[model samples]
Target: MKFSRRASANWKGTGADGSGSISTQTGALDKAPYSTKARFEDGKGTNPEELVGAAHAGCFTMKLSFVIAEMGFTPGNIDTKAKVTFEDGKITNIHLDLSATVDGMSEEDFQKAAKDAKENCPISVLLNTDITMDAKLV
Candidate 1:
């Protein structure tokens, strides 16, 4: 099966001084503000890298949950944070920091599951950059 999602952006004026708003098909973001300042400096609103990080973290966590279940372990709680490193006008790296609690699962098994998730998550596959992960069974 295949699925599609949509988001739109509208920008006006020049690159450095222009401002934009992003909107999603679900209305989760209805013309939300974004700008160069928000991306490069301390400013209000959100940026593409931040959005990518959120998506990556969410996808990896969900994938890990399924992987744990497939490995005969019950997943309790999983938390992941993705840090997307954007440098020199390119996305350089993405690092996932994960902490998970699984029932009757050893640290080695948890690490294996997390590694699988990090490598196979949809967003991870889509990104063309270095992906590193730190997974801890807690």
Candidate 2:
């Protein structure tokens, strides 16, 4: 199975003094905040890379929760953070940290389920970024 999203951005001015507008094919045009000098500096919002990080974190958390449920435990909460680090002008890695609280599960079981989720989740497969996952049951 395959899915794709298309987005385009138009930039005006120079770095540290320029701005841009990024819009997706879905009809969402986001302006980068002009007050700050950034890579996507143009309007008053976030960049696509930031949005991708958000989606990765949310998706991984939900996938982890589902894996835990399959082991007969309900997840109380999942706190996930994903960082996309760029190195040498290219995305080098996507690091993920997930803390999960579940009812009626041992740390060992949670670890196993987390490993499964990291490997089996759709986003992990779709993204070309290297993944580093830190899953702890608390």
Candidate 3:
């Protein structure tokens, strides 16, 4: 199977005052707002790091679901937060915080599945920064 996605950005004027809108192929983000202030300072819009965090969190959750099912367990629910750190114009770290509920699963097994998902998920493999996870089964 193969898949491709696209997103575009359009901006005008200088970096400090310039503003842009980002659009994605899936229409999930249609002209989402972004600006220099949004990236470097406090602004009323979204930034690249925020979007990346969202993507990572979503991807990790899906991967965990698949992993749990593969282990003969049905997941009740999984909550994940991916914190992306951007410093000095570079991405430093991605920390994944995950909590899950699954029936008839041991804490040790759940942690193993979570670790596997964090290491082998497509986005995790694609990222070049440090990745860490804090996973718990509840």
Q: Which candidate has the top score in lDDT?
A: 1
Which whole-number lDDT from 0 to 100 does residue 63 have in model 1?
Answer: 89
lDDT of each: 0.94, 0.77, 0.92
Candidate 2 residue spans exceeding 4 A from truth: 1-10, 13-18, 23-36, 40-44
lDDT of 2 at 59: 82
Q: Kindly list the per-residue Cα lDDT of model 1 for residues 1-138, writing each as its tens digit.
A: 999999999999999999999999999999999999999999999999999999999999998999999999998899899999999999999999999899799999998899999999899999999999889899
Question: Which of the two candidates, 2 or 3, achieves a greater TM-score against the reference?
Answer: 3
Once all C-alphas are superposed, what RMSD does model 2 give against the true structure?
Answer: 3.7
Q: Write the per-residue lDDT of candidate 3 for residues 1-138, one digit (tens) a residue.
A: 998989998898898899998889999999999998998889878888889899999998999999999999999999999889998889999999998899999998998999999999888988999999899899
Which has the greatest TM-score?
A: 1
Q: How many clashes in each candidate? A: 0, 8, 0
Runs in model 3 with CA error above 4 Å? Answer: none
Instruction: Please report how far candidate 2 places residue 93 from its true position, in Å.
Output: 1.0
RMSD of 1: 0.8
Clashing pairs in 3: none
Tell me the lDDT of candidate 3. 0.92
Worst 10 residues of 2 by lDDT: 32-41
lDDT (C-alpha) at residue 2 in model 1: 96
Model 2 TM-score relative to the real fold = 0.74
- CA shift of 48, model 1, Å: 0.6
